[model samples]
Target: MAYVLTGCVAVIGSNSLGLGPIAPEVARSLGSTVPTVMMAAAAFGLGTAASALFLARHIDRIGSRRMLQIALALLAAALVLSALSPMVSVLIVSQLIAGIASGIALPAIYSSAAAIAPSGRESRTIGVVLTGWTLSMVVGVALSAVLADFVHWRAVFAAIAILALAAIAMLSISKYREVLATESAPLPLEALQIKGIKPLLIACGAFMAAFYGIYGYLGDYLHHGLGQPVSANGLAALVYGLGFGAATLLDNVVDRLGARRVMPAAFLATGVVYVSMALFGGSFTMLLIAVFLWGLANHFGLNVLIMRLSAIDPARRGTIMGLNSAVTYLAGFVGTAAFAPLHTEFGFAVSTFVAAGLMVVAVLAAASRPTEAIVHTVQSERQLQ
Candidate 1:
């Protein structure tokens, strides 16, 4: 069951993060510019954000298992469509379809992790699940560049489609049920009213904006700007993913220290990394080293965000996490669109300046301390889990 959920996250992450490493190749294949090809990626982000906002609450009504099955089916179909797309417009539509599936699929994954988790072990369980990000970065993003270089860019999508299908089969025979909603489960927007949720969502948005703003052009900068082969980008992702996976070892520490206490430092580290990236991006070796640190810091940021949000409203976890994904993917769209001009004209460094600033916002948001009463309440709820 853990593997199935992990697989689902990997598949979704591939469709989202994997696009970055292969964007240059896809651009060439479709006779388009990198930014133009990225419009399809933006469309995917937009589609998922909208679907999660509107339909994520439904996961509370239906079992997570059932919701996942439906979503996997749609994702497989969308990947197949993407592999066969003849042009950017067609690719955009296919990706949007995949995004719609992901909107439901991701929240289901998170909700399931929390449901089956043993008390006091929830953070470790979630950290283990969050390793799916590393899997996507390594297997999805890293390998996609290699596959796109050696084979066709379309083959990458075809391969991810196969993984999605396998996950569906794994899910079908399992007697699975992980429903995180109760009678009081909030609607999508209502999840916002929960104490501290608004700030968390804002932090989520700013963090994602920073990542997407720089990452959307990372491959282009490495490939076109530096005259590196596509495989070089794969190597970068592999290094980053390793660092990301390694950070899971520290989740228990966060569990011990408390998420709020750790988040400010994590975001600050991320800001420093972004600053390093902006200053040293022209050096591929330095960039790879920087991204390794980038992954390390980001893993903590993502982990605690989930830890805080999930603890805040267990009854409405589906809705809360749905809003998390919605904000995250929407930020991806906004980041990509907002950074396009700077990336196109001035190269990657200029965009990193803004990305670094956004991290400051995340740092500020995370630093807002909870009242002692509220902290006591949060701690008590966590103990109950």
Candidate 2:
């Protein structure tokens, strides 16, 4: 299960983080504009949203292990196609396919992790699984930047394809297959009827929009807005990645502080960080610090959201988690598409302030209900489980 989760992170991380740093290079190579290349990120997010909304419910019928195998194969094929793409349109299509594969795989990975986790340690176990994403930001983004600078962006995609293939090989093991063989139930719409769920989803969507709004164009922002070189963009991304990686330490903190308390505070802090970057990003040192702080708070806030949702209905965990993934990437689609034009028209500061506004919405929604209510509900559900 750990191996499978790690592989999912590598696949998702490489596709997502790798593209941002190399968007300019890809635009140049394909004779496309930066905004057009940015659409590829939207395409990926939309594809993932489609799968999460439509295909995620079928994971139980299809079987998690079997579905994971198919998704990995598709992801590998998509990466290879991306590497060979001759135009922006083809690259967008490849990214869409990759997103579909990710949509299919991610819920299964999270479900498997939750199922196999020791009793009373489920959140911690899931946190460990999420660390794969953090690690990917470090390894995958850095490597993509280095390759795009020195070699070619195509090499980055090809290398990730190789990693996907390796993950597929690891999935073929009988032990891993057996671990993921549990049957999933059809997604229950009633799960959405759970208390605080609607507000939580809204908050999550807003948070995602805010995060991706800035993140999607981070490379371009550095290159054009700040006049930094690609290498510097890569290094700054590395710093943010490191902070994101370090945020997994908060798993213990979430347990101690409780997600309800931590989530709202984290959202507020992240919002402040975003605004700070918007105002003071001209200073390279300040930019690095703000970006790193943004990463740390962002990941911790996301983890808290997941922990809260998982508590709502452990029996329908896959579906709930699927909804989380769907809203997240769907927001990513909107943020990437909408914010690019904002940056083009107004500038980075205006676009980033817009993101900060979205974060304000997230903070409000997160604080709408008291933590004790959620804790009571989760505790009751656990007893029933």
Candidate 3:
């Protein structure tokens, strides 16, 4: 789990750190506009969407740890390619490859973690693994910005590649050998047809659409829309990162409150914060608080949703997790694409409210379903196995 967690953190951090701030610089170097250059981000997400559905079942059949290793190799290659790319298209392609690699690694890791954890502890286990992800955001973007100030962006990519290689090497050690050999159940797409899974997926979809819509655009909103200084933007992100990190620690609390109760509260809080950010993004202090609260609620809700899915079919761990990530990236693409046009025409307030309302719909969908004991039994068997 630690090895998987470490690899996930490196992948998410490196990619996220370079996403927003580097866009304009890459565009300038490539002789392009921000929108054109932003294709790199979209291309990356497209890779995720493609890989998750296309390769997910195979990943389950083959073994998640094996897929994870392959993903690391691909990520390393992509990072090196990104560092050396002279053309904007090449950079976009490289990032797309990296995104696919991350897409594979994430689900594999989460499924492996869920499989190994004790009964009814999937949430706590996922929280631990996700902590590394949150920590990476806290450190990755902030450090990347600081490094970009002192060094070149190419150097940043090179450094991330080196770090990925190191994590890959660590994962190959004997201590993690067991994970590589752990058995998982065959893919069960039919289970997805079950009535309960439908509402669950819908709830998750709406939640992610809203969450990523805001997340993908927050830095841009702060920098361009709100007129904040670069450092201020980074500082606000730090607050957001802290909120994500803090939410991971709330896993037990969430479990106690029940996924049903906690989810609605989180959605409502995050939605409120999004509305607040949209309304007062111009106020530095006010925006900072809003960003923090937004991060807190959004992350708590997302992790809980992930735990719910992990429990749904514990046997088909890798496939389900892969689907989870694939669906998430797909929704992210929808959110990012939707927000671009909305921000251009209707402005942030109207668009943010719409996103917030989507979250409310998610909460309602979650409310419609009752948690069942059959899912709990599956979770137990996975843990005991």
Candidate 4:
């Protein structure tokens, strides 16, 4: 079950990240500029953000497994269209459709991970599933680039489509039953009214924005500033991915500790990572070390965030996770756009500090208790006394 979920996530992750390395080839093939061809990626992100906001509530009503299968079908169609795109506009439309599928698919995957976990091992299970991102980052993405070079850029999308088909088959045969909603589920926007939800969502937004803000310029810093080759950047990506996967080994520890108890430390450690990167980004070796640590700290933080969001309310998990993912990708765009000026006027160092400042906000958001949770706890304590 975990393997199937992991495979599903791997396909989604590849759908997002695999386009970057081969954008040039895609541009040349379609007779468009690289930046123009990359509009497809942007369209996909927007499609995801919009779907997450509007379509996420339907996941519970439709059932996670069923919704996932349907979304994968949509993704397969989109990827097929992408493989056959004769122009950049067609590619953009195709990716938009793919993004729409991802918005639904990711929340379903998260909800499924929670549903399939043993009693106390939900966090660990989700952590294990999150490692699929590492698979995409370190393996699928690189392989796509290689295939684009040796075979054709279109083959990359076709390969992912095949993987999506495989995931659908695996999910169909999986025997677990989800507690699906009937026609009378809560309203779509009501998930935000749940206790402790607002703060968690705020933290998620801050964390995502901060990470992307600095990371958007990381390659440029390495290449133009440090004079490193393209291969070194790839090595940096690999090291970061390995670090991310390595941190999942300690997910059991997190499960034991409880996500709420560990939230502050995770965000703080991530803040420190940003500061260290700002301080040590000059040398290639030091930068790689910092990047690795960044990934390690980031994985724990992200893991706890997702775990908390998933556990908020089982019935509302789909909506809650949709909100989480909505902020995440939207913040990705915001971070990149907001940091561009700083990265242009200054070097990457200044933007790193700005990113760290956002982490401070994340720490505060995570540490502050929602009014309802605290009030309920206090009232319960008084009654006990």
Candidate 5:
């Protein structure tokens, strides 16, 4: 239960620290443009990426539980600071700290889930737990926007901060103690030595550049480009969220397909949507379908990759997952930053084309892997007893 709560908290932290519904309001407050206000989002991503790389192995060495406690405290502090921030720069820095807390918590929570995998339900259970976070993001964006419109954006952030702090207090309870690691595992720095993972990281990096590029600008696209209201943006976001929810529904299928088979199909589906949108940008219905499918496939691929990392080294889960999150964020930074300039010069259609190209490459890379039932290995491990 503690792990479950913390996992959700970790997942939602980035969105909470980010622009979300408050993008316009925050921009107005800072006397900045939308693109400039967006750098806060980029900063959060960079912080997550950097911290995940730097602190992942340390969590493995110290123990996930202790790290969770510390992370929660940091998160609480960062939120408070952000709530009271007097300047945009201070707010951005606070957001970076929040990103670090998020980065630290993700691997530890994932490691805990992998550690506590019950009987034959590891994948499903993991999916269910992770869904909480995705749900938070979808809800957070829309709800936070509403709150920002009604109340001040600062109040919206203050509410999120309080929730995070509440979660921290809950996590400190004795009943949730199992989240702690028993013995410090020696960091398997050699996991980096896994020849294919580095290349896989590069491929993912490119994929993310495209992913974030489109997604980072999606709200703006709907609002500025399409002249839609925030309510419309929320509805669109709902469609995208449904896509993520759909993937969780298919978690068992994903587990059966394994990474090699699942990843390529997802990327292909994503490319199809992006290409369709690029060729015909004015069709709202078509774009909606594209966004929904893209969200579904992209998130499915993301969860699949996450599960794969959790499988790599059972005992050193925090380190591995942390490293993966770091990579994930690094990709986000590249995607967001890359898209901003592209959106400025070429427009959304061409920018989406760029994203589609990256997905094509990701599909090819995913296909190159040997498909020998990596998912079945856990079943084999169970049978060996």
Candidate 6:
């Protein structure tokens, strides 16, 4: 189950991060500008948000396994379309389709992870699954850079398609088929009204906006602001991904320190790193270090958030997770779309600080009473155990 969940998430990561490293090159090839090409990211996020809002409710009714299979098929088709796209519009549409697939797939995977997780080890199980996303940062973003530099950007999508197909094959095995037979309760609309959910959703939105705003443009920033070669984009992403992957090992730390204490700290630390990037990004070493720290803090905070949300309502885990995904991706869309203009008009420093400010807001929001509620909830669950 863990392996299957990881494989599914890896496809999501590839589809999400695949275009970042090659945005500039794709723009050049399509006779467009970098900011224009970046719209694909926004489109993808919008699609994901839409799917999470409208389609995710059906996951519990249809069963996670079936939903995952449908999502994988969508992803495969989207990748092929992306590879074959002749115009920027077509590429944007392809990305949108891929994003919708991811939105549908990821929440199902998360719900499955929660359902099958061993008692007292739920966070660890979810963390292990999320590591697939971090690995995607390496394999998807980093490798895309190398491939884009050597072969062509189109090859990146083709590679992702193959991986998606592999994941489908893995799911087709008899063991997974048996797992998919289990049915979950339908998602309740009242899940939205659960205590602490609203604030957490707000925090997630702010955090994603801040994080993706910088990340969506990191490649162009390195090329334009630091005057680095195209290859540096992938190398920097690799370093950041390594940090993210490494941080997953510390999921146990969240259990020890408690999420209430850790989440605000991570948000604060990530904010500082974002500001540092703004101040010292001209130095390649400093930029790399800041990016690494950003990934580390961001992923830690995200893990805690996921664990908390998953624990909120076991019966509605799918719904809560899906809504969480929707909020995050909507923020991603806004951030990516907003950053392009901010960076274009005021340059990297201003844009970076804008992101940092959003992180600060997220920190404040997360540190509020909702966090206390989460801490109490976790403590109550542990006492029951």
Question: Largest lDDT belongs to which candidate?
Answer: 4
Regions more than 4 Å wrong, model 1: 19-37, 86-88, 142-155, 179-186, 223-230, 279-282, 344-350, 369-385
- In the range 1-385, model 4's lDDT, one tens digit per residue, is 9889999999999989999889999998888898898889889988898888788878888898999999999999999999999889999999999999999999889888988999889778988889999999999889999999999999999999999999999998899798887655455467678888899988998999998888777888899999999778788889999999999888888889998888889999988988888898888999898899889888899889988888877887888878888888899989888998999998788888888888899999988988899898799899999
Clashes of each: 0, 0, 0, 0, 1, 0
lDDT of 3 by residue, 153-174 (tens): 6777887888887767766763
Candidates by lDDT, descending order: 4, 1, 6, 2, 3, 5
Q: Please, what are the lDDT tens digits per residue for candidate 2 over residues 1-385?
A: 7656766776777787678768999999999998899788778878888887667666655566677778889999999999999999999999999989888888777766766666556556667777778778778787787999899999999998998888878878747533321555554465466566777898999999988888778878898877888777668767887787777776677777777898899888888998898889888889999998987887788778877776765555567767878988888878877998998898888887888899889989988875656788689899999
Instruction: Write the residue-wise lDDT of candidate 5 on 170-280 in tens digits.
Output: 666636334444665444456575434554665567667777789877777777888878677777777887787677778787767665567678778888888887876
Candidate-wise lDDT, in order = 0.84, 0.80, 0.73, 0.89, 0.71, 0.82
List the candidates' TM-scores in order. Answer: 0.86, 0.84, 0.86, 0.97, 0.84, 0.85
Task: Flag regions of model 3 displaced more than 4 Å.
Answer: 30-33, 174-191, 223-225, 278-282, 370-385
Point out where model 5 deviates above 4 Å: 2-18, 27-37, 174-191, 223-231, 370-385
What is the Cα-based lDDT of residue 57 in candidate 4? 78
The total of clashing pairs for model 5 equals 1
Please report the TM-score between candidate 2 and the true structure: 0.84
Clash pairs for candidate 1:
none
Q: What value of lDDT does candidate 2 attain over all alpha carbons?
A: 0.80
